[model samples]
Target: MEKRVAIIGAGTSGLLACKYTLEKGFNPIVFEAEEGVGGLWRHTIEFTKLQTTISTYQFSDFSWHSFAKEESPNSQQMLHYLNSYAQHFSLFPYIKFNSKVMEVEYVGESSEEMEIWELWGGNGRPFFSKGTWHIAVQDTKNFSRESLIKLVQQQTWRPNLNRRMMALRCKSTRRHLETGVHQREVYEAEFVILCIGKYSGVPNIPLFPPGQGPEVFKGKVLHSMNYSALDNKIAAELIKDKRVTVIGSQKSAIDIATECAHANGVKYPCTMIQRSAHWFFPELNILGIDIEYFYANRFAELLVHKPGESFLLSLVATLLSPLRWGLAKVAESYLRWRLPMKKYGLVPSYSILQGISSCRIGVLAENFYDKLKEGSILIKKSQSFGFCKEGLLINGEAKPLETDIVILATGYKGDEKLQSIFKSHVFQKYIIGSKSSSVPLYRQIIHPRIPQLAIIGYAESLSNLYSSEMRCQWLAHFLDGNIELPTITEMEKDVKVWDDNMKLHAGEYYWKSCIANCGIWYNDQLCKDIGCNHRRKKGLFAELFEPYGPKDYVGLSHKR
Candidate 1:
C-alpha cells in the first residue's frame, strides 16, 4: 500500500493538499470536523457574500465565472462552487467528514523493540520512542486511552521493522453508533500536513473581569460565529423591536450591524460600539476603478519589499503625505455628502493608504448609508465596554445602554485555536514559548523542531486561495523530493528575518503570522523557490503601472 498522509481539516487548503498529495503518489486522508467541505464558507447563511472580488477569491485551476452567475458570489454560491470543484477533481472519496482530530503523537524507535505508553493530560503526548506516529477520538474530555492502546496493538501486531507511525486521535460517528465506543487509529506515514485555516476553530471573545459573565447581562449575548449560523427566522425574532448593540469595527461588526438594522424591515435599529476609529472603504470602487486594482494588484505591489517597506516608495508616500491625505479628503467629502457620517461622528482618523496597506479595507454593504440616514443604525464611538446594573456601559458615557441583544464580532483568536490541538508543553516551548509570539514556521510552512510536518494556510495574503495554492505547489514538490529545505539553523534564521521584517512593515500587534499586508512579498518568495518567474507582465509601463491579480499568477509553478 502507498504510504499514508494525515491531513487535518477539509477547507480550501486541505482540499488542495489532497490534490497535490495524489499528484505526488501519496494516499491522503482528510479529517474534517464539519459535515461539509467549504470550511467557514460552508457555515454562512444566505446574506453572506465574499468581501474580495471573485477574481481575487478563486483558485488557479477553477474559475468562479465558470460556475457562479455573479461577479462576487454569495456564500451559498461559493459552497456550491467548492462542491463542483471537488466533483471535478473527484476528491470526495478521500474526505472523512465529521471527524475531529483529538491528538497526534510519534511512536516506536529505530527497529529493535516496542515499549509501553501511558496517558496524561495538559502536556505533550508522551513519546516512548523516536518513530513517527499519530493516534484517538472526540474532544479532550471524551478520550479513552485503553481503547486507543487496544486498537494500536491490533493494528501493529507484526514484528517492528523501522516503523514510522503518526497516531491520530480522532472522533468519528460510525464507531460510536455501531460499537458504542470511540474510533481511534494510528497512521504510519512518511509525512503529515496540517491545512487548518486561521478561522473557524475558536471565537475570540473579550475577557471580562471576574464575576461578569453573560449571565449578568439581561440581553441575549452571542459571538458573531453563532449569529452567522442563525437561521433567518431566529435571527429576525432575536432583534425584533429591540435595541441591539454590536461590538467591533471590522467586517463582521459592520455586517452584523447592517443585518440587525435591516432585520424585520428596520424594526430594531442597532448601535455600533467601536473601540477605536478605523479607516473603512465605503465602496470597493474608487474613482471608477476597483480599490484592489489600485492597491493589491501588481504595480502597486512592486513598490514594497520584504518587511513591507520601501526606500523609494516609502519616501514618496511620506513626502506626498499631503497628497495622500488630500485624496482621502476627497473620498471622505463624497461619502459625507451622501451619508450622515458627520452627524453620527463616524469620521475616520487614519488615511486610506494606511488601511489598505494593513489589509483593513471594509466594503460598505448595500443600503448601509441609507440605513444610517433612516436612523436604523447608530454609531457610539467608545474606547472600551463595561457592564452596568441594567445593561452595558460605553466608555466616556455615564448612561447605560439598554440593549436587547449584544453581538460580539471581534474576530478569531488564532494562536489559542492553533495551540489547542497539540499538547500544552510542545505548543508552548516549540510553537509559542511563554512569551506570546507569531507563528515561527519557516517560509510559513514548516517548523525547525517539528519533523515531517507542514502547515498550510497559516500565512494569509491578499488572496488566500491563490496564496494557499502556491504553498501547496511548493509543498508537493518538496514532498516528492524535488524541492529541498535548508538546515535547521538556516531555517530558524529565515523565520527570524520574516518576523522582524513583518514587525517593521505591519507594525506591532498586527496579525504578524499572516501575510495579509505582504501578499506580493510572500508569493514572490514562494515563486522563486518553485523556479517560477515572479513577474507576470513585461515592459516598463506594465512593470510600473499595470495592476496584477490572480489571472497573472495562475499555474505559475509549472512555468519553469
Candidate 2:
C-alpha cells in the first residue's frame, strides 16, 4: 500500500485515478500543472456550455448533481461541479497543485515483484488535502458488455491526455529530479497510474494560407476557445450592421455561424461556407427518426436491441455520418411527419454534445443553420480560404462583404505539446496496443518494459469514459498482480492488429490517437480477456448509462 502512484493532471481522469487508487489501497500522488484541478474542462475548452451526447456518458452512480443554470451547464457550471466532486470526495489532500512532474524514468530492472517509479515535482504549492476524491464503485450484476459499460460511465468528464504526454519534455523544467527517462529523486513504487489527459492538446486545425489567415482578418479571427465577451459584444454590434461568415466544418465553425445568424437577424447577411452538407438536429439527436416522438417510444426500441455484434456490429446498423447526412437531406425535402413541427432538428451548434456524462463538453451544440434558414435566421454559404482587407475571400473569387467583427471559431491543437514523441523513431516503430502504450507501454495502459508503471487516459478511439475508467480498473488489477500482462510477443501481436484496424476504419492520423473514451479502438478485447472484472461485471452502475433513459435519445437522437 505504500507503493507511490503518480498522476500528472488534476483534471477529471486525474481525480478519478485518485479515487480508484485509494479504494484499491495504493498511494496515489497526483501532480497537476494547473494551479487548480479540472484540466482543460477547467482551463481552456472553447465553448462554456459544452454538453455530451454519449448515452452512457456519465458515471454509473453519480446523479446529475449540478443544476447547470441554463438547459445545460456552462463552463463555470462544469467547473463548479468538478470542484464540488473534488471537495465532497475529499480529493484535495492527495494533489500537488502548481507542481509539474517534469519527467519519468524506467530505471533498472527490479528483482522484487514490484516496479519502481522515480517520482519528483516542484517544491511549489502545498497539497490542499491528502486524498483527492477517493470513492469506491461496486457493480455486481448484469450480463451484457453494455451493462458493464453503464457501471463505468458514472465518472463523466475525462480529458484526452495522449498528446500532452510530450509535456514530459516539451515543457521541461529543472528543480527536483530530471533526466531523459531516468529522472532523479527516483521514488520506486509497485504501481504507477498515469492520469495525464489527452484531448485539449489534440486539435486538428486544418491549416490554410498562413499569413493571409487570421492575421489577415481586419477585425478578429481568434480560436474558438479564446473567443469570449469582447468577441460576443462586437458580434452583437456587427449583427446590427454588417455581413458575417463562419468557416470550418467542425463543431466550432458551426457554433459561431449559428450564433451570428441568430444574433444578426435581418441586418447582417450571414454566410456559412460548408464544404459539404450536414444533417441538423436538436440539442439531442436522433439519426433517422422524426424529432418529436423519436425520443419517446420509437427510439427506445432501437437502444434496447441488444449488442449488434462485439459492440462493433452496431457500426453496420448505425451507418456512418457520410451515409447518414445524405439520407437526412432526402427526408427533410420529402418526408412530412404528422407531429407538430417547431423548427425540428435545429438546435444550437453548441448542442452537438455526444460525450459521456463523466467528461461532458463545456458548451451546447444545437442546430442553428435550419433556424436561420427559416427567415428569423440569416445564413448562406461561401467557403473562403482567408480574408482580404476589404472583407473575407471566398474560394478564389474575391468576394468582399464588409463592416465590423469576425469570430474565427477556429479550434485548438492538443497534440502540439507532444510534437517530440511523434518525431521519435521509437514512437513510430512500436506505436500499437492503443492502450496508452506509446512509451514502451502496451495498449496505452501499461509499459511492458516497465511492468508496474501504468497510465489511464490514452485509448484514443470511439468510447472515452468507458475506456478511461476501464484502464484505471485494469491498472489497479495489473499493479495488484491480480491479472497478467500480454507476453511481449502477444503484446506485439495485439499492437499489429490495432495498428491495422485503426488504419482500416479510422485513418493514418489515428496512429497517434486522442479518443480516450472507447477502449475498443485498440485492445478492448484484451482487457476483456484478462478479466478486468469491472468491464465484465453487470454491476449497478450500468443502469444509469442507458441512452434511452434520457428523453429524445431514442433513435430520436444519437442516444447510443
Provide the TM-score for each candidate, comma-separated.
0.81, 0.60
lDDT of 1 by residue, 272-319 (tens): 888765555555666667766555654455444445355886675456
State candidate 1's TM-score. 0.81
Which segments of candidate 1 are over 4 A away from where they belong? Answer: 108-130, 139-188, 307-342, 433-436, 538-540, 557-560
Clashes of 2: 98
Evaluate model 2: give its TM-score. 0.60
Cα lDDT tens digits, model 2, 1-560, are 23456666777678767766676666566666445677766543333354443333334334344534344556666667677767777677776554444334433333232212221111111121121111111211212344323432211222322232322311222233433332233233334455666544334444667666556657755444434323345435645545666555445566666666566665665565555333333444344443322222222222221211345545543544444344434434432232112243322222111221112222234545354555434433444466667566666564565635555554444333332222233323333323432333456565443344455665443334444555565555444545545455555565554444333333322335433223332233434534532122144443223222221111111111
Clashes of each: 15, 98
lDDT for model 1, on a 0 to 1 scale? 0.65
Q: How much is 121 displaced in model 1, in angstroms?
A: 26
